[model samples]
Target: MSSAQSSMQLSNVSDPLRVHVPPNETPEERKRRIAAEKKAKKISEAIDKQLKAERDEMEKTRGTKLLLLGSSESGKTTVLKQLKIIHGKGLENEREQYRHIVHLNVLTAIKALAKGFEVNNLTLENSENDEHLAAILSLSSIKESLNRQSLSLQAAVGGLKSADDATAILLANYESVKAVWSDSAVQKYFESANDIGLQDSAKYFLDNVDRLAQENYLPTDEDILQARIRTLGVTEHKFDINSTTYKIYDVGGHRSQRQYWAPYFDDVNAIIFMAAVSAFDQPLEEDLRINRMRDSLDLFNTICNHPLFKNTSIILFLNKIDILKKKLNRLQLKTYFKEYQGANDFQSVTKFFRREFLSRNKVVDKNVYVHFTHATDTTQMRVIVASVNDMIQRENLKASGLI
Candidate 1:
């Protein structure tokens, strides 16, 4: 057989299987098939249009989402609480919730003062306080024990009333706390409380020891605002302003808790980045070697230049200005921030830190609104929050091309 004749034979064998045969359809059947396809197409189009309308409605009704980002003890939670008091319902009903926390604050402050005394090699002025010091230190040891065994600070403190003897210990030794807190040497240590990592509220609580120790004492609004508790995870609060709902998220600022932050980056309209200007002389509780102000600056730089937040409006809150002002009167900013050459006065120091934070923004077009805030002052925060809300609304409108 020739090669051409063999190829022809192979084609004949494969052609039958390769060819596709359509079944014959009547005219009526053809009409029904086309009509069915058109009906399906109409349904799909209607579904798509309905979905688009739903999405538009949702976008119209959605509220502004703001993230409060800051280092631990930078007053983020205080800001949140102020907002709750100003916009949402007042903290009147919630005052009782913080009674134990107020007690804990006193305990924590005294323990820090005691530790400061030990670290500074200073003795209590009153030798009689030696017994009281022992009692206070015993409470400190109990706190440490509860912290180690409990999964969270809330759990540990919550157990203070029932699951543990910390409350009794605290009550029994609160008078001791008062005694140690009043010691001349302890007061000297408290002068550098920032250096010793004492909370900003320590002075307030320690000052009101007698009032707080009253049998039925409830935390006042100021006490609740000043109470320092380390935020463990993410907290959300919602309030309405000018018919627009606003959701504020307060996330833990510790390094360990930072992992929970990225999940909230998406769809965030604004970020309120708080830096404790007073923390210039202090160290981070998480890493004692790193200065708290330096850590805040580094974190601010990262967030300002982050790809995810390139377009997100940023509000820089130089919080704890009151503390910073007091500290500057005694401690020089240049001592901690070596690059600082300005005077130790409040104006010069604040201007320098503001410049430092603004200089970190790599995006030339991005504007960071800076505010010097005292988070505990409700009157001041009321004004700041109003301005912030206006700025956010304007920014959102601009983003949507409505401006």
Candidate 2:
């Protein structure tokens, strides 16, 4: 064979067995060629080694990551708190932190009730309630001023101090709060507090005013779960279950805060989407023109059909079932959701919402597991969490071809 033909044949051979030598090469040139080949091989091996190390590191650090998403007041944070109580370290260390929040919840409830009375043009049952209303309103004004000032100062001062002062004021006028809340006219508005933008926890706090007014009260786990605070940014919580580390990300659910959600979507194993089923009669806190339930359905549809989350498991939490149960007797589901033709019972309403959410999955064959949950119920949440854990693990195994 000719020299060119031989060289081509040698080049096509496998790397380990192949040797390329020019037909008319000098001894010195041959030595240099060998040295060059040795150096190229070493560099290639080094690159392979580095890439393997990186892969190993990624595998070692990889864990199950769950993203919690929803509209405002949809119980996303409460679910997170429940996980902390059940699977992770309990909330004993954060009792004091929650104490102030719980106290603030009481004040917020009273203020909301006081405002509700005016909005509905209702009068107090007794003239004595006028003095009580004045005290509550005065305290509320002070709190609002402190809040505005704190915002102007970028919250550097007077935030926590204002909460503390409000708590003290609440304790001082404990009887007044009780008296105003007990007024028959105020109760009428309180019954429709959701329509007037009251927090879901207001009733719980208002009902427990006597216990909350105590000097040395620390919040119970249930109390902590009932507390409502708008999540401003993203929060990461880590816990271990069954020898697997779990990283749960709770991002703000407000429309403005949703811009921060995309970064967490890339590597998520599952998403727990919360929706307050009880909010059918309520409007969005951000935009009063839109009904809260309608907003949730639209948001869920977007997330459920997003291309990036095609392979990610979605766990839909129809949260606040307790509130829905209470509201059904007072507010008609068909009033807000005109398309809801089903009867206005808990089963019909919950199933209707569940179908609405599931129908949002435009992706072919995508399954969304639905759960009707009261996030503040610790026992019920424990069972749901376990079921979610098992489902995620099964999905992960299927993805890895290990099942």
Candidate 3:
């Protein structure tokens, strides 16, 4: 007998008491109910197991890992520092440490312009136009001046408790340096910005030497932004955004340091590639024959087409737009890149450059996000950084099937 039939009992006392079947459930209906319950329980167990697996994976991987990649001086380090300013720790104290670099930048900018004279074949007095070759080797003092300043700045940064006294002396020495730089023979080279290009910020610092030479002077965000320092190795910065931790890696961009980049390429979630847009007219410091813009494009192409990063996200930062805007009226883009057909204005030129870079992307179906950035501007960086945070989080969540 079925359980339902077994449960039913006849009441003997009530004159032919009826056998009651509770709710009249049949054998087939009971079998179906049991089967349905078992199926539901199995599905529940499977879902719980999947959720547990995902949680474990999430716990192990932590949050998104963002990688910064580009050729040297593409502003990768600056972008990483921006991440520090927005989402990092101990940056306030760290800012003081960068003071020496600022002094060094001013010195390097001056030296770069002075060095241009040699590259352009300009010599000091006593070299006639047609008579004979000038004593080109006598220009050793230009390099010597740079070395002396570098040594002095290093000494000050190491020994002095305050940067003001040493900076004051450096500025005082600048008067004599400016006299040498302003000489008519050297002024001719500055007109065309040929050979080694001088930084636009060089004049800004020179103009305000009196104010900046003070011992109490601290580098502003703009000063730090314009300061150029080549990163040497991999630097990792940590930050938490939207309930997820982010590990951002900034690597050296120099040619020699590129071999170190491959190890970090694996397990990376996204890459923020920086290209110095203003470098269209300038050459790479490592190899003066190769245009900086060309190097940036080549590096971008390699990163986009890499098999390891096929699924990784790419964000292109067209850096130094502020300098580009300033130089448009002064320097012609076509003079450097003969193939550029766009107008001389900022919008047209930037668009042309952007297309030139984007055309090199070999990866299909992957959209590369581009941002025109002035790395020194903290205000603009804050907005851009927040946008990047959102994009990374959304992409990561989708990849993990949490969206």
Candidate 4:
């Protein structure tokens, strides 16, 4: 996976994924299938026995955390949904594939945590009781959570700017409450105040998530908690051949939650940075759309120097080419951009990426490959998954001293 050839692979003429050997009797079809079986066997040997340790190390140490960072509604969720289909099943059932597709619902997690706040924030018209104090604290805590740039989560509740200030200024600022606890009692009571509202709405939120998780039946608290636990392990994907399962840490792309992005690099053995070609054309300064690309570059720069990812085999996916397929020219994207600050030319965008995100011809950059992918189309989707699996195969080969 550490070679530029890591991104290249043999694929069938009819398909960008599979290939088969020429059959002695059959002209095309049987020939292809036979070749496929042989290729699958070779790839499998390369993966299971040769590169098993590297892949296993990925399982054990650094989960090549596939960070799908893009602003909300930028089709990041759609990308994830598409991946689940590939992983849940298989592109074409290749015997050698090792990539595990996992999806993290960061927005859903934020919404659930927010619901706890919304429930707490609703102060009743006639309530001044002790129970209400808890609600107020909950409200304050939630507000803080909503306002956070990201949640590494030090103390969810406890810090006070001085007990006297907690009632006023500190409580009002979401950041202040975030500093302490988003689950504090006093914060909930205030947030639940009839004036602030949302107590009734929280029930609906919980009910929906629970029902969905339970396969259309309402789930017990245990099920919801288990689901939550699953969401936290994906900072970067960790793998091990020693075990059947590996851990992955997924990164978030929300503008307000970007702060949580960098900390995950500490543990990753490999990195998959997802980007959109849209940024090259329709770059924007303020919009959420462009912020994803900008943030990816920002976060990648953070990972590049970080001890964990510096030499790690990193894959850069130019996701959502389906949208770009319709693109006409650089000039068309001018409207998408707020203003052409420096890169008014098409070459400038390329220059911008070179100066910013790329590692400037490091050995890692050579191994660091870019794969253009459209996750929705079955054909293209196969290509993308195969590309990643191929990278893993090469790594396995190198580990076994075969290449």
Candidate 5:
């Protein structure tokens, strides 16, 4: 026996599970023992090799990862949803699920619009008297009426065919409702939407109530684009471009959910930070006192200076530019942000914010790509997203010395 083997045996002599290798005289026994040891060593080496190969392959195929980051309701999830609609494979089957969300979205928008007018003390006036809008949107009455209609619709259809049966009743008096929305007083009150959580697509959904109420209604691209669902946790999606696989990670922007973002920071190729342009006049739903834009700016600063993301490329998406365009004409940017000394037009607001974002970026030797986006504009999004993908790919290639 070799000295090492003898020492091993001696050390394990007192152990109950120790294997006994006898110092026998027979050459046949020695030969069989060596063969057994050789076979076991070869098997272990093969297993180690196979495990190493698998780890290597996993590292290689994880490919380039992109992360979506923003403050709550800043449209990060909307951008991710857009990516899924645009680049996802086999997503046609997911349309039915999104249809229900669209129905719910329209319902939610109506409730918000009514609430906006109500909370701001705005009234819809007829020649008779000053009619408080809240009286029309009273939750107790609407809930009871909606329940009755939804039950009836479900019973006749043998199931809940449409998500919102209340849409029909809401549509019946649509013209009057629209007139209230068009009122200058109500539009002025809409600037305080931070407290109201008003949807920008309120008019669009209210106008399309008839089409949306149809039993066989399939969601249109516009419907899907305008729909909003608060993301609760991180969701990952994968797709291929030019035969190169890419993984995109989306995380919730709510303060409670931000704790879960650290795990996804490693190996990210680019960070798409979305800030809602229209939110300049709004307040955060979570904290009524905090301005939504200020919250977004703080989050942006944190991400730009984060040690884990030091090498990562940053892309800025100033979303909801369409809403900003309309709001800019009526609501002065200086009303909310006193620092703004320029004209209250779309161009001025966008340019100022663009410069604002650029100045906030602290990353050295990196240019932050800024895009003015309207999340619901799919045609424009298709072009913007393609440009974004190309930028990310080029950055990745350059990093890997492949350019």
Candidate 6:
């Protein structure tokens, strides 16, 4: 191992970070800390003075929260990135605030974790050929990305969402330097849903993020790294979501991860259910989209039926339609809602899901509808995302008599 790794293993801050104290200070120097604290407090107030206090109450997200819950890789994070660009400056503080409240602390722990790691780390299952790169994410690393929070775009879905789910997903994948990873030993040895300890670790990690920032050692580099990515990888531009600003909660679509979706429903206000077009019939190796959709839909049924989410507004996004550009037809999609255009191809597959899955329980009381697009190909995904956003906003309006 490199010196860095060796130093890191020994560097775990088992206790809280140390206070920055000057060397060989006399009793009189203790007052220096008081002065310093006052000065720092003044600086913070001055910087924030430019921003208005009723910021949250001024625009769309103030009253309503939107959650992006769907199968993994459904482009929820990408959509939030799009919103950051569209609402730039206007929602800059909101985005930063969300990141601050959500992702700050464990970022420190992740740094500590990565410090102990060496490049080219890998683990074997049965043989060297079966080995793979070490998993980088940990429950502790998720920080504020989980936990209960007030609301944002994700609130539009249901209360189950915490921060922007989509944003958190991409943040986890950002440059190795910007974000930290779980030590290979920890990831391989202890990370699992069944590992009840992870739940506590997740809670503890969030508490630190909240506590550290409250003490003003916040807006750290990793926090800024997440903020810098606020507008990263988004494709939507014309989508006029509620007041043109949104906080989207993204959900994992994998079978193993689906169970995590339930706890987020308590506070969400809106929902975007993503269905990937390209994932429909692809083999598992080709993509997990198909299974993710089926699993997600089943989960959606669970969410909608939940007493708290029964009245929530939900918009269904048919993500990844670009992959089917050569194969798709509007007329064909219309057939999905019809009795028989020979329910085949994309329409048939989706129709079967809707009819079987959504109709089975039938508890959803708020507006619910499906639209299609490819999340990656902006040309098509743009329309789908926009349509979903607009539709959900309209539902909110109709319910509130705002329109």
Question: What lDDT would each prediction earn against the true structure?
Answer: 0.80, 0.81, 0.69, 0.42, 0.70, 0.46
TM-score of 1: 0.82
Question: What's the TM-score of every candidate structure?
Answer: 0.82, 0.82, 0.75, 0.40, 0.72, 0.41
Indicate the residue-level lDDT of 14 in model 4.
Answer: 59
Over 4 Å off in model 2, which ranges? 1-60, 140-162
Tens-digit per-residue lDDT, 1-403, candidate 2: 9999999997777786567678999999999999999999999999999997896567547868889999988998888888889887898997877777777777767876786676567788899889999888777434552221011111212444654665677788899889998888888767766655577877788899899889999899989888777777898988777666788899888888899999998988899999989888888767889998899999999998898899888999999999889889878888888888899899888889888888888998786899999899999999998898889889977986869
lDDT of 1 at 107: 70
Q: Per-residue CA lDDT of candidate 1, range 60-154, in tens?
A: 57778889998887888888889889998988887765776676666766776776576667778899998888776666344542222012357
What are the root-mean-square deviations of the candidates from the true structure over C-alphas? 11.7, 7.9, 10.1, 17.5, 11.7, 28.5
Segments in model 3 whose C-alpha atoms lie over 4 Å from true places: 1-61, 115-174, 177-191, 197-200
lDDT, residue 216, candidate 1: 80
By TM-score, is 3 or 4 better? 3
Sorted on TM-score, highest at the top, how do the candidates line up?
A: 2, 1, 3, 5, 6, 4
lDDT of 6: 0.46
Summing lDDT over every window of 10 consecutive residues in candidate 5, give the lowest-scoring window: 144-153
Query: By TM-score, how accurate is candidate 3?
Result: 0.75
Across 206-283, the per-residue lDDT of candidate 5 in tens digits comes to 567668767677776667666566666888877766555678788888778899999999878899999988888877
Write model 4 residue lDDT over 143-202, tens digit each, in one string.
343222222222121232322232233224324223223334534443323222121122
Model 4 global lDDT (CA atoms, 0 to 1): 0.42
